[model samples]
Each structure stands twice: as C-alpha cells, then as structure tokens.
Target chain A: MNRSALVSQAEPRDFIALLKPRVMSLVVFTALTGIVIAPGGVHPVLAAISLLCIAVGAGASGALNMWYDADIDALMGRTATRPIPAGRVTPGEALAFGLVLSVLSVLVLGLVANWLAAGLLAFTIFFYAVIYTMWLKRWTPQNIVIGGAAGAFPPMIGWAAVTGSVSLESLVLFLIIFIWTPPHFWALALIKSEDYARAGVPMLPVACGEAETRRQILLYTLVLAPVGMAPWFLGFAGLTYGVVAAAGGLGMIWLAIEIYRRREGAAARKASGRMFAFSILYLFALFAVLLVEQGILARIL
Target chain B: MAEQPTEAGIVLTPEEKRRQRQRNIAIALALAGLCVIFWIVTMVKGAAILQRPM
Candidate 1:
C-alpha cells in the first residue's frame, strides 16, 4: 500500500485505543461512586453528563500520556502495541485529539455541571499530562505515588459536580484511591520490573530492588487497610460496606504478604500477579459496596 | 457539486471510505443530540442560567 493509503487506514479504533479504555473504565467507576456517595441530589441527566465529561477527561489524559510516552512505550513489551507506538496513530494526532478532548470536556463540564468540577477536571488533565507523564515518570521512583493523585481526583471532581465544593467526605474518597495506588501499582511493577528497567522508567522495583518494593507494598497495604474502612467508621456507609471493606482490606494485606514472602521464581511472579489482580477487585468491591449502601440501599431503606 | 479535499493528499481504500462516511454520520448525529441536550438544559434551568447567586 502507498504511504497516504496507510495513513488513511487509521480507524476509529486507533483513536479509542489512544483513550486507554481500561483505565477510563476504572475512572468512570470511581467517579460514579463519588457521585452516588455525595450527600445531595443531582438530576439524572446532569449526573450522566458529569460522568461523560469525567470519562472524556480521563480519555484525554490517556491520549496525552501515550503521546508523551510513545518512545518508552515502544521500549516496553506491555505497551509496545499502543496506537502511537504501533504507528497506527501519529503522536501529533494523539496530541491534537487529547488537547481537543481536554478543552471540550472541561468546558462542557463547566457549563453543564459546575465550575469547581470542571476546574478539577482541567487540573487532572494537567496533572497527569504534565506533572506525572512529563516529569515524575522519568524522574522518580515515586512517580505512581505522586501521580496517583491525578487518578484520585475523579471522585472528588464527581463529588464537586453535585456539591459545587470539596468536603471531608470527598477527601476521604480521594484518600482511599491515593493510598491504594502505590501498593496496587508496585505489585504490577514487581512483575514488570524488567519492562520498566528496559524502558528506563524508575519504577520502585527498577530503582530500589524487588525486596524493598515488596516491603513498601506491605507498608502501604497496612496503612490502606484502616483507611479503606474509614467510610464505615465515619458513619457515611452502612454495615455492609464496613464488613466488605474490612474483609477486602485483610485480603489485600494477605496477598501483599504472600507477595513479600514469595520472591524468587515463578512463585514470586504469580504472587505479584495475584496481588495486582486482587487489588483491583479489592478497590472495586469496596467502592461497589459503598455505592450500594449510600446510593441504592439508602434510597430503599 | 464538488468533492472537498477533507483527506487531502491521503488516498483511502473503498472500505476506509465507507467507514469514514459512517463516522461522519455518527458525528453529525452526536452533534444533533448535543444540540437537543443544550436546549433541554436551557429549558430546565431557565432564569437560573442567568441569575446571580447572592
């Protein structure tokens, strides 16, 4: 095929891939939880709009991340097939797509929801694109630790969409994700240390050895276990949430311990993989329980 | 009358051209839906859209 023909062959799916749909799903879920948990009423349509904006904003962040990290992504096995790296979409296209979506998401959110939420959305795009992607990812082993705040903001932004202001409650939701990120990501980093090392990214495992990474993961999980139960203790969530959070937190800690113990061979990889997988479910179950308690159960009872 | 140079210098296969048409239609429909949403929001908010908060 000719050059222009090859360029013209870029499909809509390539654009979607730029969005990082999996990451966007997590953002959507957490943001929805925030919307449901916030102590107020929002029109269903407006709530839907707010969620759309959050999802699009998340997509924009992913696109920008891909644009910036295309080089490193090409180096990493796990990311070698991303749109930009695969040559299905150019970096310029991804940059323009991201910039357009970022502005559109923020503007529509400001008009439809509230400015506070929109501002938060804009800041999230900036934080992920500039601070995390451009700076921390290349510079520090604590990249995911500090960069996690960008992901954590969606819930707060969702909460602000309704309340027009941040509250202690919203901060609690933010804290849960912020604290949860390091251990969750570190587990994956342990499994993918070679990928990070190859890509020249200073992930904890790549920079500090696997043992230290495991130790930090255990420490973070220890802190997260209690904080995960905060919604229950704070009285916003019901007994269901408290029980689930406690159980899930223990499960996470157990998995982290397993990860810490099994550190030599395929057993270590399996343990790390299990911990990473379970961490996702742990967060999802915690949020799902909270959503049911605050949003559904509250409405019924 | 005229075929505009939207994909200038980029020749597309028939399948790509078909997909492009589909995408264009989808985008147009989405824009229309957005217009409807804007109308509904304006109607719902009414004076509040312009009102100053004290």
Candidate 2:
C-alpha cells in the first residue's frame, strides 16, 4: 500500500502546471483590478465566483496551449520538459483536460456571474488556443502583435462581468494592455532569437533582424507610454495611476534605448531582461494604483 | 538541427489505438457530466446575459 497507489496516474503537479500557474497570478490580479474599479458594485459572492471563472478560463487556455504546442515544446529547450512532452500526461489527455475545463468555466460563469463574461471567457480561450496557437504562431512574425489581443481581453471581460456591459473606461484598460504587449514581448524576443530560430519559430528578432526588432520595440514603447496614461486623462482612474504609469513608461523607454544601443549579445540580453522584469512590475503597479484609486473614490462617494 | 522525420499523417499505433478506445469512453462520460451541469445551471437561473429589455 504505497501512499500514491490510489492516484497513480493523475499526478497533481502536471495538473497544476497545466494551468500556467505563474502567469495566472498576474492575470488574476489585473482582472481583480478591472472588476473592482469599474463603475458599479458587484455582489461579493458574484465577484469571487467571476474571478474564479476567469482563473479557470485562463488555466484552460494554458492547458490547451500546452496540448497544441506539444510538438514545438519537444523541439525547444525552454519547453521540452512540459507535462505532455515529459510523458507525464499524453497530449490527448492534455487536450481533453483543457476542453473539459473550458466548457466548465463558461458554464460556471454564466450561472454564477453573467453570460457576458462567459462569452468573453469562451472567446479568450478560443483566441489563445486556436487563433494564436493554431494559426498565427507558425504563420507570421506579426503573431505576437495580433495574438496579444487574446491576453488583453481579460481586463475588459472582468469589467463587463461587474458592470454587465462594456464602457469607455474598460476600453482604456484594454488599450493599455494591448499597447504594452508588443514591447514587452519583443524584449524577450531579442534575447531568445537563436532559440526561436533553432525551433523554427519565426520570432521578430530572427525574421526581421535585431536592429529592426529593436527599432520596433522603441516605436511600440513610444506609443504605449501615452496609451498607458489614458486612464489618468479619462478620469476613469486617478492621478496616482497616471503618475506611476508615466514613470513606468519612461523606465520602459530607457530600457528600450539601452537595448537599442547595445550589441545583440550579453549586454543587450541583460538590458532586455531587465525590461522584461520591469514590464511585469510596471503593469501590476499601474493596475494596483487603479484599484486603490477606486477604493478611495468609493469611500468619498 | 535536422527536422525529425515522423509518420505525420498517421495517428495509429497499437498503444494509440487502445488509448483511443478508452479516450472515446472518457469523452462520452465527460459530455454526460457537462449536460447535467448545463441543466442544473439553467434550473438555477435564466439566461446569463443581464441586458435591458427593449
């Protein structure tokens, strides 16, 4: 009688990893900001349930992504040891797991929260699993640019889940995420060009060359900084989010400039890596300020 | 790195064939569970869309 005898096949770790648990932290946090900040109140239970649905929907997308990209995962050093690739779970098993979770999430959201959110959640899963993974990923260098819309939809969906409709304020959040995505992604691409090339993944650095990729990064950052401040201008968020977003935008541009000046070697890698790390923090801090601003506003109102 | 030559169009091995049978059964059971969940949810509430009636 070994302790693991009852559940010999269904390892907990594979299941947890399927959810892309690390990315879920940021997704959940930003989504919570969208939910709490949108004008109107959500029942505490409904809010919790909506967030749970969003989490499961995100996890479902990750599992489906792992399933679809199992071939690529086995090729690339970075992803070669994922659950499906490692034989911890078969690709078929991973697909089934993702499909089941996807449907369950939509149904749960529809019943527990609202259909608007359920529909958005359904679309997000489809966009990531099918649009990005199945189509855009292998087809073009514009993959991340367009595929980024899938990730950006969550904040807006979270807003609609609370307010029960889309609004200009929610669209501001969407714009920020959409604009922030390309520069954030290209920074990682600059360092991983060789890996992507070896894996036959046509990333920006490999497809367009380093100098061009760097220039695109700078251009996108230029656009993103102003977009990040949309909340401050619209009065959807407060002065705090505005100021912090401006500082983060400047930090992003500084890092992009450093990457632009440096060679595409260790120096550029370190600069791009710093930008990647700061990008995560930048998005989170901005959203956190939005949540705080909303809390203050609610107290005053 | 050489692109590994694989039997791309084929999805059937002895092991895969056996696994496919079990998978079909599993899928049926899962679909049944989903249908049950769907019914229960609808009984719990009406439509999910909270829209203004015009």
Candidate 3:
C-alpha cells in the first residue's frame, strides 16, 4: 500500500460538511423557538449555550449518520457528494468526530442548562445514529415516519431546557414536526425514487409505489395543516401566528392536492417538486412566526 | 536531517500539513470558546453552579 495514498486530504470544510449544517440550522431555529416560548425565561447566556449544545448535538448526529451511511450514500445521487461518500473524510474520522462532539455537547448542555435537556439531546443523537440510520433506514419503507421523531425532539429539548420538564405545549410542537415529516420527505421521495431504489433504501416511493406515496403525502398534509395551527389555537400565539399558520396550512394542502391530482409527465414531476419546495417554506414559516411572536411577547411582558 | 515522518511512519504532504494546521487551529478555538462559556456560566450561577437540577 502506498503511504502517500493513506494520508487524508480532507479540509476543515469537509468536517463541517459532515455535520450537515442545513439540518443543524433547522434544529437550531426550532429549538430556539422552544427556548423563547417557555414561560419563565432563561438567562441570555445560558440560553445561547443551550442552543449551541443542541446545534452541536444535532451536528454530531449528522456526522454519525454520514459515517454509517457512506456506502448507501455513495450509491444515491442526492447523497453522493457528502463528505464521506465524496472521499473527503474517512468514516473513522467522522465517527470519532461525532462521538467526541456528542459527549461534549450533552455534557455542556447538562452543565449549563438542565439534565432533562441533556438527556433529550443524548437520546436524539442515539435515535438518529442508531435507530434511524443503522436499523430503520434499510429495513422499512416507514423509516422516516418513525425516524422523524429524532428531528422533532429539538423543540421539546429546548422547552425542557427552560422549564426543567416536558409539557403539553412542547409535545404539540413535537407533533407538528412529526406529522410534517412524512409529506415533506415523501414528496422528495416521489421525485428521487430511482436514487433510493438504486441505494437499496426502501423509501415509500421505492417500496410502496408512487401512487401510494402521493396518497400518503396528501394524508399527512391533511393532518399537518391542523397540527401546524395548534400553537396559535392553544393560546401561546397571537392573531398573526394564527393567520400565517392558516395560510401556510392552506398552501400546503393545496400543493398536496396538486401532488395527488397530477400523476404523470413533467406535470407530475413538477407537482412533486413544487410540493417538496413548498413544504420547506411551510415549515420554516410556521417556526419563524412562532419565534417572532413569542420573542416579541417575551420582550413586552 | 530530513523531515521526520509521524509515529504512523507516514510523511504528511504539504497540503496535508496545511489542513492539519487548520484543523488544529479550529480545535484550539473551539476549546477556547468552551472555556469562556464555562467561565461565564460559573459567574452567572455565582457559587451555586454545582446544584444542578435533575
């Protein structure tokens, strides 16, 4: 073996890429909303630290996921350019990085915030790394349906950080994300069914067929629309939030209907693509509204 | 004397060396940030930082 070939050529950016920053950003945003919305406020510094810990923990999960999924990632066009699959970072290096960050983030969160948050963070990492990536991903078509719980946890963890316990409100936040995941992912799956089929991953579109996937997308969206508005109706938010949620929920439903109605040609692909794109906006707008509303209320009262 | 190879008996190329340096710097910065956070939290907690909640 050539010693020269054994030396890593990975850059620091590759390490960052391993963390899945885009996913981390969403986690941070949702978690931050959780922190801000809790009744009694946290110290600004502590809150910042908690957010940091959550973000790093989420990143750690991402790294661990990439480390384990490298082979399948290499096969899928969507994931082919990931750090490990792209040959920028080794799986061993990614695993080490993930493990180190996971421990550090959890410990720091426990020390700076509360143990509940830390415990949730730890479980979130374990779920994403072990349950979802290692076990569920290749085994079932319903992989993301259950794996979405890992993503749903941040806001609850954030709420726990502030209140030192879980509550109904936090669980509602969790429910919204959990329901939203199926439609959001299935729309993308509808488009990239071939990539998933190639990777031997049993996403709904690959395993259950496109018609079933589209029907499921519509079903989940119907559920998500009402759940997305629960925060407003539940009294944590004001009229603006209610209005935005209602509008976004309608938009999501409309797009989902389009996805269900249009079933072939570029029109079908376009419907799926539009649904995929709009789902992101729908979720982002929902969280952003909650964050803004709660932020202003927190400041005023 | 020639440049020494690492304990693994592999010589790092110039690009590898540069990246290693970059990673080391990032690690140092991260450590420093953690220290600052710990210190600030200690000050905020004011001698009761150890009384953690379950």
Candidate 4:
C-alpha cells in the first residue's frame, strides 16, 4: 500500500491527539506550581493566560515532535498509534498546526504577560522541537540528559510571567526537574530499550547497554536527592516541604537501588516500571508540597 | 450537479458531514474566544499596554 494513501482525513480529535495532552498536562501542572511558588504577584487573569500559553506551547512542541518523528513513531510499538503514524493526520498538516500554535502561544503570552516569559516560551519550543527532536534525539545516548532542559524551562517561564525576572528560586525549580528527568526517563528506557533499538533511536539503555544505563540512573538519582532538597534547605520552602522532599528523595533513591540490584528478567522490568511510576509521583509531590506551602498555606496562615 | 468528492474520492456521509461541521464550529468558537481574551487583556492593561518593551 502507498504510504501517503494510508492517511485518512484528520478530525479535530486527531489534532488534539497530536498535541500529546498527557505531556501537556504535566507541563501545565509544573508551570502552574512555579507560578504559585514565585515570590511575587500577577493578576489572576494574567497568570491564567501565562499558563494557557505554556500549555499550548508545550503542545505545539509535541505536535512538531510527532511530525518529525512519524517515521520512528510508526516503527515503535509504543508510539505507533499516535495521530501522524496512525494515518489520522499527515505530517504537513501536523507541521502547520504546530507552527501556528507555536506562534500564537508566543504572541499571546507576550501581549498578556511580559516578553521575558514569552521569550523563554519561544526558546523552549525551539529547544524541544529543533534542538532535542531534530538533533540530539537520534545522535546520542545522552539525549535525555541534555534535552531535559527543554522540560525544565517551563517553571522558569512561569516564574518570569509572575515576577518579570528570573530568580535563584526559579532556577532551583529548574534544576530539580532538569536533574530528575534522567532517572525518570532512563527507568522507562530500561524497559523500552527494544522499542528504541527498533526505531534506531539511541536511548541510554540501547546505546550504552542496560547495565551502564542502570548505573547512570542510580548516579543521577544520588545527585537528585540532594538537589531536590536544596529549596527546603535554602529556606525557599517551609518545614512541611522539607519533610516531603526528604521522604520523596529517599523513595526515589530506594527505587533506583532496586533497579540497580534487580538486573534481569521480569524482576528487572518490574523494578524499572515501579521506578518510573514512582518518579512521576515523586516530582509531583515535591511541587504539590511547595504549592501548598507557598500558595495555599501561606494565604490561610 | 453531483456532489463534489474529496481528493481521495471519499464522499462524506451525512454523519461525517455533521462531524466536520461541528469541528469547524468548534475551531471558529475557539478563535473567537481567543480574540475576546486579547481584547479584555488590552483593556485591563490600558495605556500601560504600549509601555511594554516589545
């Protein structure tokens, strides 16, 4: 069958799927947390606008990624059902959709929020779409290590939307996600190494072997443990945040250790799956604690 | 006149046509909502809106 002929007419739902709503939700949550924890004020409406722009920009990046990666996505079992690869949307259509959303998001953010926030949003789109997707993803095993910066930018952009400037506090938030990404992704890579290998993408486990990838996941988690607690230690957060960070950091390290110790068969896959699932909760709990301390609890007390 | 078919020669059934209409309406509504938002924001910012450093 002719590949182009396989493409069906795209529906609105297909376009929505192209946006990768699950990934966009994570971006929105973390970015909203950044806004809540920042040590300044923005009008409620403006804050909402900033969040909307961030979410759209993240979606735009996802769409562009899907368009460019349609080939590999078709090959990989995990991504084969995605809109472009599933023949529900054409790559040209995805490209146009992403590009339009990218421009609209940046322009709207700049008009409603400060240009600094808008610029960060723009750079984030470029970093994810071009730098990570186009260049690093296929080229190196360290792709997630460096490309993690794209995901890390959202909080900083959110903080800038509120304060009109980047601060040490926002950078701490950035560093937390940046450091957390490697372990989070490597755990999944350990399980999906075959998918990545089939797609010709040099994920850590595929490129460097599972044993080395597991070791790297442990090392990154060790570093993340201290860095994740840095905000609480530095007094940017309260005692409640401090406790949650300590507990979550310990949980993350334990999971990483489990992944390292159980290195074969179904046990290893189970360990990696547990680590990946817990990593999401770990990051979410850290930010949720901060949001409560700085946004809600601060207001109440 | 015969109904025009898509380039793929797939003619839309009535249900598909209804869905396409709904999608177009949704897109229009979303665009209208965005314009309304921008207008409200501009009003709120007022003279200070132009003072933004690009």
Candidate 5:
C-alpha cells in the first residue's frame, strides 16, 4: 500500500487498479449467472464481451468514486491506501479513466448484446458515480440503501443481455442485492463508525444511536428474508432456492441479533465483522444455489 | 494529522487545471470510439440475424 513501493515499478498497474477487482469479480459472477439463468442463449463471444463491459463499467464507477472521495478516503484508515488517496493516480486522472471506461462498457455491451442491457449498464455507472457518490453519499443515512440499487443492477443487466427485457427473475435478483446492502454495509459501518465519523459521513450508526441502527438492520433483514424467497414463491426459481434462501436469511438474522445483543465490546465488534464477511458469502451462496437449481439441479432435485 | 492541507473545494492549480482539461478530452475521445465500435458491431449482428431464415 506504500506509494514509494508502487511508484518505482516501470510498468504501472494503474489501469487495472481502477476497476476494483474484488468488486468486479462479484459483478462478473452475478452477471454471468444472470446470463445463464435467463431464458434465451447469448452467443459465447458476445456473452464474454457483455460481462467484460459490466466489469469495466463497475470499475469505472469505482474509479470515479475514488476520485471524488480521495480527500475523505485518505482520512479514513480503510480507504487511505487506494490509488487516488495514495497519490498513485490524480483525481482528474481517475475521473477521466473512469469516464472513458464507463462509456466503453455500456457501448460494448449494447453492441454485443442489446441496447437495453447497455442502456441499463450506462445508467448503473451514472447512478453509482453521479447519483450515489456525487449527490446521495454525504447527504443521507439512506446512502447505501438507495445506492444499493446501483450495485444490484449487474444481474439485471446480465439478464437483460439474454432476454432483452426485464423479468420477474431479474427483479428478484435485484431485490436480493437491494435488501442485502443495508445490513451488509451497516454491519461494517457499525465497526467502522469511527472512520465514517472522522470523514463527516453520516452513516446510520453515526446518525442514529447503535440500538436504532440495530433495529433498522433487523427490520431490513425481516423484509430481505421474505424477498429472497420471492423468486421461488413466484415460480421463477425452484424449491431448492427457496430452502437455501430461507436458511441464509435465518442465518443472517441470527448474526444480526448477535450484533444487537453484543454491541459494546470487542466480541460484539468481531461479531459484526463476522456478519459483514458472512453476508458476502451468503449472497454468493444464495445466487450460486439459485443458478444450480434453475439450470442444473432442477432435473435431479 | 495526515489530512490534505487544503479543504475539499480548494481551487485547482494551473497545472491541475491543465491535467483536468487533458483528461476531459481523452475521456470524450474514448467515449466516441466506443460509440463507433458499438454501432459497427450492432450493424453486423443485425445483418446476420436478418439473413437467417425464419
């Protein structure tokens, strides 16, 4: 993370760094799932390109976000080492890079798949960079709540790539991510309240007391659990998806309760961290289970 | 102790403004290239689809 260490390399990884590879990977996986699970088939080459664009677009959004938040990022311990904050990339450079990539991703996906998918992808980058980061982030406790919709678009975009329109299945995928974001992020916010506080970001835990935040998390999970099962209930997904989603929901609730119960100490903090980490795993699993059931396991199970 | 010396809205230096302009131009150009490519691909795909027998 040291700037000097990264600076001397003759070859710069600057372009690759912009994409937020960790986030891109998840976006790729979910988007791919959307393509495969949707009704019609996309040509393999086109599918590859579409997914590539989605990844690039997601990265572009991340870069733009980093550009805007560079000052705040440097202040927060967790974000201080990002390329923009570390001075590896300038804010203008990052913004330009992101803007270029965002345009490319949307166009490529539109060309390779459908304009609808590309249009959605373009809107997603806009929502994330302009709306979420530029407008909503510093202004509201609902930052992640509303901003969550932007991240939730990948699977929908992927589904659109195949079907060329939105459907019940895609919406369900959107709902899972939408509902998951608050609790998932709130868990981290609970732990990193100091980082957000220092940055003057009005995250939920900082705005409302810990108890109220915990209540909000639990309430969101209560809604999320039911929404997660909706695909199965609506007949877009199989029973296995229902069962797994139900289990994951309960598991998430259990951790949320533990977080609420143990709010004051190292153990409570660790519990929140545990939930934050597990929530990620839970989402991936929930999607993976949906894919398996709808595509492969539907026949056997 | 390590916060940026300037506040969030500090005016960009001349060098920074120049960099920003260049970046803006580059982004605009890249976006144009993407549009060109997207159109070409879609046209090719559409032609192929139309050629196919129903």
Candidate 6:
C-alpha cells in the first residue's frame, strides 16, 4: 500500500458498522424491557439517556472486539466485511473510538442514572473486550458460556438504572439470557464448524466435535426451557408472558431434539440452522411479551 | 487547492477530503447532541441534579 492511500477513507456508515448496530439493538430492547418492568419508573428523558448510554456501551465493546479480532475476522466469511477487516477503518482508529465511547457512556450513565448502573456497564465493556474477545474466545471452547454474561448485563443495568439497585427479578432476567446463550450460539457453531476451525476460534463444534456440540446444545436447551418460564412461575410476569415463554420453551426443546437426531450431511446443517434462527425468535418473543405485558397491558388493566 | 497536504506532507484525495468532512460533521453533531442532553438533564433535575447518590 502506498503512503498516500494510508489516510483514512472511511465513511460515516463504516463508523456505525464498527458499533455492531444489530447487537446494539438487542441490548437496547432487553434493557428497555428491564426499565419498563421494574416497580418504579424513571423520568422519560432520563430513561432515554440510560438506554442510549447502554446502547453506546454495547457498541463500544463491539468496536473493541472487532479491533482485537480483525485478524481472525478476516479469515471468516461472515465477519470478513467488518470495518477494520475490510480495510475501511484502521485498528488504531477503532480502538480509540471504542475507548472514547466506553468512557463517555459510563460517565453519562452515572450522571443520568446511577453509579451502580454505570459500574455494571463499565464491567460489561471490560468483560466483553478484555476477558471474552482477547482471552477466552481463542483459549477455550466455553468462551460464549462465560462471555454471555456480558450480554446478560444490559437488563440488569437497566433495572439498576430505574431502581438504583439490583434485585431477584433482575437477576432472573440475567439468568434466562445466560442459560439461553450456550444453546443459541452452539447451534450456529454447529453449522459453522469449518469456519471456526479456519479462523482458529475454538468454538464448541470445532473443539468438541459435532456430536458433543449437539449434545451440549440439547442439555443447555433442556435447562433453558425451564429457566425461560421462570418469570411466569416466579410471579413477576402475567399469563401472556407465561403462554409465550412456555410455547417458546417447547419450540426450543423440539428444535434441539431435531438437531440432535439429524447428524448427517445437509440434514444436520438444516437442523442446526433452524435451531439458530428459532433461538433468536424465541428469545425475542419472550422479551417482547414481557415488555408488552409490563409496559402496556399492566397499565391498561 | 483540491488536495490539502497535512503535517506529514501527505495529500488527501478528493474522496478522502469528502469523507473527512463527513466525519467532522458527525463529530460536531454528536457533541451538540451531548450538550443538549446535559442541558435537558439539568432542567429535569432542577437543583436536585447535584445531589447524586453515593
């Protein structure tokens, strides 16, 4: 590359892509649910600020992940088009962008919400960037298992923002996502074993073989089925959430069974892919149900 | 003066300049948004904004 081409030619959209907007959306949705479901409410403007800070914090972690994982990301077809890997943005720029946003998000969250929420946000950024991306991802197959806590913290942080403290209900929300992560991610890992191997990522299927990965997915799904319905059973949520959670739990189990049974050729890939897609819908439906119940239905009734 | 040379004596192409201008505008908008947020928070909290929880 010539020295003249070294000057950054990245567009604004490239900066947005660096934030992993899709993942940020999920974090914001789940965090918003936490805020809505909590006992007391926050000022509307303050709530918006809290959500913005949490979204930015999640985005910052994603940038740092992309910066650190650029090498391996380039090797994988799925992640190869990310800003740093695609050569639209340089690693130093991404790192600086991530660090700046991380600090600002934490600081602003503390000002608008509470230090507890801000502290959780900061820990989540550190856990994802330093612990999961830098260390656990390459070092162990259980990377997503532990690293999933980072994703789970958004709802807890949201709850903290509203109530200014953590509670059992918030921890239950955290647990649901934490337990759901293994089956959710391992399903995709099963389908992308070759890609994982190529990138040297040591994902479950690459490390433990497809048979064990499928078994682990089934085990985790079995656990998730019960945990997913806990909000209904524990009395925090109403009948609508119970029905949606029960149905989603059953769907997760059935899909896991299909993935476990079909272990040959395209059949295996299709089954894993179905599980991967359904897991996203299942989790989204659960949170969406909870959000509507607590946010709207509760108000009306 | 289509291509402006920086301190390193490296000149940016027209596309680079356009992108740089876009980035600069984005930064300006973001800073302005931050200021607005802070001001709104102050108004919402009134004198109570300074009394934060430990």
The number of the candidate with the highest lDDT is 6
Ranking by lDDT: 6, 3, 4, 1, 5, 2
- Tens digits of per-residue lDDT for model 5, A169-209: 89889988999999999999999999999999989998886
Native contact recovery (fnat) for each candidate is 0.14, 0.00, 0.68, 0.24, 0.03, 0.57
| DockQ values of all predictions | 0.23, 0.05, 0.52, 0.35, 0.07, 0.53
At residue B10, what lDDT does model 6 achieve? Answer: 67
Native contact share for candidate 4: 0.24
Candidate 4: deviation at residue A111, Å? 0.7
Q: Using TM-score as the measure, which candidate wins?
A: 6
lDDT of 4 by residue, A245-268 (tens): 899999999999999999989999
| Alpha-carbon shift of residue A214 in model 1 (angstroms) | 0.4
Residues A37-91 of candidate 6: C-alpha lDDT, one tens digit per residue: 9888789999999999999999999999999999999999889999888888999
Candidate RMSDs in Å, in order, are: 3.4, 7.6, 2.2, 2.5, 7.4, 1.9
CAPRI verdict on model 6?
medium
Task: Note the residue pairs that clash in candidate 6.
Answer: none
> Judged by DockQ relative to the true structure, which candidate is superior, 2 or 5?
5
Error of 3 at A110 (Å): 0.3
State each model's CA lDDT, in order.
0.89, 0.80, 0.92, 0.90, 0.82, 0.92
Candidate 2 residue-wise lDDT, A1-301, digit = tens: 3212211244556777988998778778878888888777866656776787798899999999999988888887778888877776767778988998999888778766677878888999999999999999888998999989888888888888887788898888888888888889888888777778887888898888988889998899989888898888887777778889899999988988887898656888899999888898889888888888885466578
What does the lDDT read for residue A197 in candidate 4? 98
Model 1 chain A poorest 10 in a row by lDDT? A1-10
Clashing pairs in 5: none
Worst 10 residues of 4 chain A by lDDT: A1-10
lDDT of 3 by residue, B1-54 (tens): 123555757666687899889988988998999899999999988877889999
What TM-score fits each model?
0.93, 0.83, 0.96, 0.94, 0.83, 0.97
Q: Is candidate 3 or candidate 6 better by TM-score?
A: 6
